[model samples]
Target chain A: MADYKNNTIPGLIGFFLLTYGLFFPSLSAEWVSFIIDRLQESMEIMDSGQLLIASFAYISRNALLYFLIYFSTLLIVSALTKNTDSIAFSFLFISATLTAVFLINEFYGESSSYAPHFFSLGLLLALNSYITKQRYYYLTFAVILFFLITAMQCLNLIPLLSQWSFGADDLAISLKTADSFITEDQLFTALYFVLFAIFFLIAVIFALLVHLFNIQITTLKRFQVQEKELKETRFALTESKVYEEIHSLVHDLKTPLVTVRGLISLIAMKYEKTEDKKLQDYLTRVDHSIDKMNEMISEILYENTKKEIDVDEFLRYVISHLVLDDQKIRLEMEVQENLPYIHVNKIRFARAIANLLENAIISFEGKAGFIQIDVKKVNDTVRFQIRDNGPGIKEELMQEIWKEGFSTKDSSGLGLSFVKRVVENHQGTIFVSSTPGSHTQMDIYLPVSSGQGGAFYDIDHR
Target chain B: MKKSSAVIGCFLAGLLLAASPFARPDSAASINSYPNLPAPIGEETILFTSAGQAPENLLLAKMAEDLHLEGDYRPRALASDLYDYRTLVIIVGNSPYGLQYRNKTFTEESDRIKQLLNEAELREVPVIILHVAGTKRQDNQTVELIETTAPYADYFLGLKSISSSTKIIESMDAANVPVTLVQDLEDLHTPLNSAFR
Candidate 1:
């Protein structure tokens, strides 16, 4: 459509040439008939009345023919070009050219009976353009102007045109005579003017309506865009406020843990020289548990505190966090030899994996179910696969499970969403596949750490 | 682009030059063919009208006045207009614009003319068919009108220069009606004057 509009000028030129080429001969024939009839009248072979009627008939026929040809050509050109603007422009150009020719003929002292007919044709062409392309104010103006011009020309009210005498060179004078005869019928003459006025009013009202409609649509689209932007800004503000509150709450938790750890160290020092080994060992285990808790707090408060941990060691930490006391559920683990270490926040990464295991165990609802964990290296990353034979997640609920506050069970729905956040923060990816009423599997890939330490590095927890 | 424009201009010029001759009216000498029988005459108070509502009725009306023929001119005269009329002179030609201005379709016009002709036949009013606009008025619709009105017409008058004058002559000959083919509208004055008185 844009391309068609862009080429409108060229298209107009082409159509103008086509219209002139097609109608030239018909116009010429009308002129020639008028001249011949006048000559016959001079020879006393035909009377003035017959000459006048013949001239009127020939011009009227040509006018009707030209109207048909112009209308059909516009339709065909519009169809071929798929451009109404171009066709309307072409029609206007041709109509103007015809009007110019009529005016030029009149100025040269030749009275053309077909001049008003051609002007009327121009009025019709303008009306067509106004109706089809009402958005263009120029076309509406053209319609109004053409209608007035046609009325003036038809009524012989044009001061300059009325001064000219009917010459033998042009046959269109007979049309002027016919108009005089028609005007003698007062009702018909009034009705004709009324019709033209009505059409002009209709064109003006329609153009105004179209203009208002376009403005309304533009305003509506603008409001829609602003509404969408406001929604996104409000959502982002809410997310940031939640993160700020969580960070403040976690920072306050470190104070109490620090005092408890210092008191336990003091008690261990007092019992160091005594022969009480079991008590000493128990105290050491308590101190180590406090340290692990502190590490988890650090992981929550900050995201960048990460260290490399062996894949197998990470799996053991995850299992230790889960309670496997339920008899209806069984757990299995498989770790490939020489698996690459993954760089991640140990406490949060283990907690995310533990949440998955807990969800799997809960899915059993006290029914017998088996959960299997597999760790292996592929390319530059380590993958963990956790499979469970239980009531699997439905296809529709799979994506929803990872959204905050979305859950199908009687629990806070933050488990999967938290897991997804932790994995994404560590630049890892998680995927899930499930068969409803059968089994479910989850795969997590974490990029391997560049550093290599002892093959069996351990983190103690009591 | 300039070359293409020039070529198209040349092509269009050739077409215009080629079509100029065809656009001119036939320049051959007019032929006047009359039947052997004397022209039929009708009483005064003739009804001058049009068969297909052409503007030619106005011209014919003027011609009737010039010939001192007393008649009423009704371009869209209905069958009821035939009251007390002794002769019906209908100018036969079709103008699409004329029909449109009068808010009539070809079918309605044809039916109206048929009704008027039928009323004339019942009233025994002498009907004369005139085809005066020459070949410019000859079309399928006008030809059909002529054919439909021929059988009821008592006399046929038309121009000799029109190409379809042959068809009009043929229809009149087939209907066994006397037809007068004249050189121009002026020549129709003599025959028309004779027919009225």
Candidate 2:
């Protein structure tokens, strides 16, 4: 059996010893006193051998009564409840047993006073842990048991349960009174049977409660898990929807842009021998717009790569996508060699940084702009600072730039938000600052192995 | 709890005393000099260390030598053993001892040395570690253990080179106990010689 199962035997012995020591300091002497007094009273009625044997038998019987009552309390608890919360109940049961044992060893044994309350509390607590964890069930069981036990006590059914007892005269009178109402042997017999019934009733209630609530708790937990799964499903659906919309939009625009480029090339071919000022300027402007469109499409396609991409590689890819004709727009990076990699969504994050490049390029629309991208590993985080000496975003437009779809141009303000999403996903952050004509700087922060050089303890759920 | 702890403590002390054959301290260990006396006092503290097995006669002989204000060099015959928590207890048995025992505790002395260190610490005594994680078995953890234990000591020393940077000190604790590095040992001579005078 488990440690809690065979607890009563030791508990009962401990209780007996504890109470015996506390109340009856001189236990053996007290028992001798009671036996001697009894012998003196019945001295004339029996022979010496018979008197000696009878007195010894009487003391033995009283000792046996204490053990019986102790065992009976345990049996009642054991039979009535299977839930172990009854440690407190068992304690009360032990206390009552101890008190009852002390009283029995007394010359004039009487009924116990606290027997009903402790038995009620102990049984209820133990039953609470086992039978039902619900507050109402516990309160209800406690009330019902209390009333039932109290009702049994009124009928002289609760053992070691009686009122004031006088001496021998009182005992004789009470027995005679009890005999007149009912047979002497039948008084506690019904109570004993009722106690057994209480035991069985408690056991049955305990089993049923565990059975009912076990099902409820398990069902509740399953439902919570399902709810979490449903939430994740909704998020995944939203992401896929956004992805589908962008992919189709880019695909449809590809054909028209290619046709427009073809027409521009045809015009340039037709005017191959002509050296007119207006024609050259028009052709040059047309070529520049085509370059811009091509770069935008390239950015759109590259942004859709699903795998995690190295941040530095993604930076280089973004620069290449820009199609910079002027060597000045080609960003010079002071990146350290073989830098530690930061976790990034290749497509989405590349798009965000690419948009920053696009803005820098546009700000220099008529004049050449010098853009510099620096990637540094400081301690454990990667810091990417993209600086541009473009018409550094107008002071009034700076705040509105990051607001989604609130772009100065026709494109969505989603680029910065997308960048934010990528940075946040990598347990990092982004910052934007513009000196309004001197330079515009967008800095992104991403952690690399958490500052402890070389190793990160990953709780890998994937 | 106190009685059980005391019992374990006594068992730890008795084992350390029994294992070091040269560690037997005569009552008048003070009236003796180094390299002539069976055991020397007022000498540098010597600690024999390896992996797995606890140094026998580890702390007592040091403490007994220290009582007479001698250079307390406690010698330990190291038995290679490895105690790891994430993995099973792996005994790297390449010591001078002829018998090869696995991860299991070979004797009571080995089992109690760690406790002896803890007890010695309670009394405010410096612990001299002499771990022998040789070149054949060098790693990050061995380097870390060597570095961590070095600072708490008044004069830090090691028997074997754990890293390329650590300088090996040829000075003995007196008699034949060898230490690899003796940081701050030069500063100790003035006070030691004054006491000697």
Candidate 3:
């Protein structure tokens, strides 16, 4: 697990250059022996220890020559480009040029059998990139390219080579031998076969290594993502605990307020026909204020409890409460027939709808306006569009509508924001679109119930 | 890099000169090694046994097949009757240890081979003589057989040690026949193919 990312392209090139310097000598020597024997058309050159030594010396010199060139190139590239991608581009250019030169020389009888080495070099380059970026696809691409190059080189073996002058007698014998096979070119044939075997083995090993490595990397990445998600969820859970305490406190306050409202009602009912009618009117206002407070408190406490309810019944209940409070605004509701039960907090959902209706009523500003609530089952979810024909919100204020404590009118700006929060808590979404003087539409979506047991509300169920 | 390459090049050139006597540019001909082997005389060839009993004629035929040479191997046929053959291959050795010729005695076989060589010489068919049986065939009788038949051959292909004897070497030199000496029995195909070619 050394970090290849920190390794620069020039350094990688230098490393490969060092590798070539160490290993290419033997390969080059073998190639030289093959070339000498092929030219002689006899094994005399191969048998002569002197020729082998000369070949080894010659190949080593050449290897030394190229290695120095590459090493200097690496040094220059690293010095100039440093850790930049330009070095990779330059190195690839150099490698491609070198590979082409070597291959041409191999085919032209200066040498033979550099393909497997080039293949290995290419695999190393690709593997370097893959390891640095942890991108398995790069390795996959390299493997494919390696096979393609090998196959192409194998096909190149089909042609007869530019042969050696093996005396006239050796040439005649070689030609006779050549007549029986597809190509009389034994050198090309031998080189490609050996190269293919070596490359094939290398490809299999590299593929296995890449495959296993990719699987490990993918699994590791997936685990890291899941761990991050778990951490975020745990943090959110801790934060939600604070809201639960506040909701409990609000729930507790409702009991005393209800008792106080009952006492105020008794006082107002006893003095209904009294001369002090002002007191009676004030008590009635207090009762109405208490009722609003209770509704707000119930909305706050409406967390984590859900029940399956008929869509039509739920819409009717919300509409009944709205119509009783304001008979001036015309309220219209349309529910699709045979709609499935939705799993959600009925009270909270109703409060959210009620808030929308209240906003629509206030938009009318005592002038008659129409509010339409449309409910239907679409796919696996229930959709509700609450549209109002009041003076629509300006486009400038639209984006700010969902912001907490943001309002265009004189009031506490928590109603629409709270509605959005409640809708989101039920795994649902609400969208709004409006045009000035035309209409404003609020569309809400909630997932339909799967008929599993939920935290049922007795009042809603009954 | 340039300096290192120069130093390495000088060292390698020095090593090359030190290791090979023929490393001199003018000695290029020495590197080609024994350039006077017989040229191939087209595909019309026949592998004819001189001693008549060397069962290796079949083996040489298989070798011909392996070398991709188109030829017929007839151990008992008269060379004069082979009008279509361009070349005659005479295997000049006797098989021992239950592998000898049953049809003729050593004298009869040698006479028959002498007749075959005369017929081949008259017909102007190039003859390739192979003394591949090594030391086993260099007995006094076999030497006599070789002396009679080998001087008629255009090429002498055999083991180096077997051909190194003063008599055969002198005979080869006198006949102006080029000798291609192989190391072992299986190595005969190189020289064989060279003769056929």
lDDT (tens digit, per residue) of candidate 2 on A399-443: 566544556666644666566665665566677777765887877
For A1-462, candidate 1 gives per-residue lDDT tens digits of 876664575456546654663555445554545544453342233344544455444434444334433443443455455555454444444544455445434433233344343444444444444345445533454444433443333343211232221121223333323333333224224543555456456555654566566678778989999997786567557767887998888888788888999889899888889888899889989999998888888987878789888888888777777787845787899999987668888878888899889889888988898999988887677888899988888777765677666678867667888888888777777878788888888877776853422121111111
Among incorrect, acceptable, medium and high, the docking class of model 2 is incorrect
**Per-residue CA lDDT of candidate 3, range A34-142, in tens?**
4333322222222233322332333334434343434434334444454323435445434543554464344322223333334333443443343333354333534
| The candidate that achieves the highest lDDT relative to the unseen native structure | 1
Tens-place lDDT per residue, model 2, B58-103, is 2223222333432322222322221111111111112211112222
Please give the range of 10 consecutive residues that has the lowest summed lDDT in model 1 chain A: A453-462
* Fraction of native contacts (fnat) of each candidate: 0.00, 0.00, 0.00
RMSD (CA, angstroms), candidate 1? 15.9
lDDT of 2 at A367: 80
Model 3's CAPRI class is incorrect
DockQ of each: 0.03, 0.00, 0.03
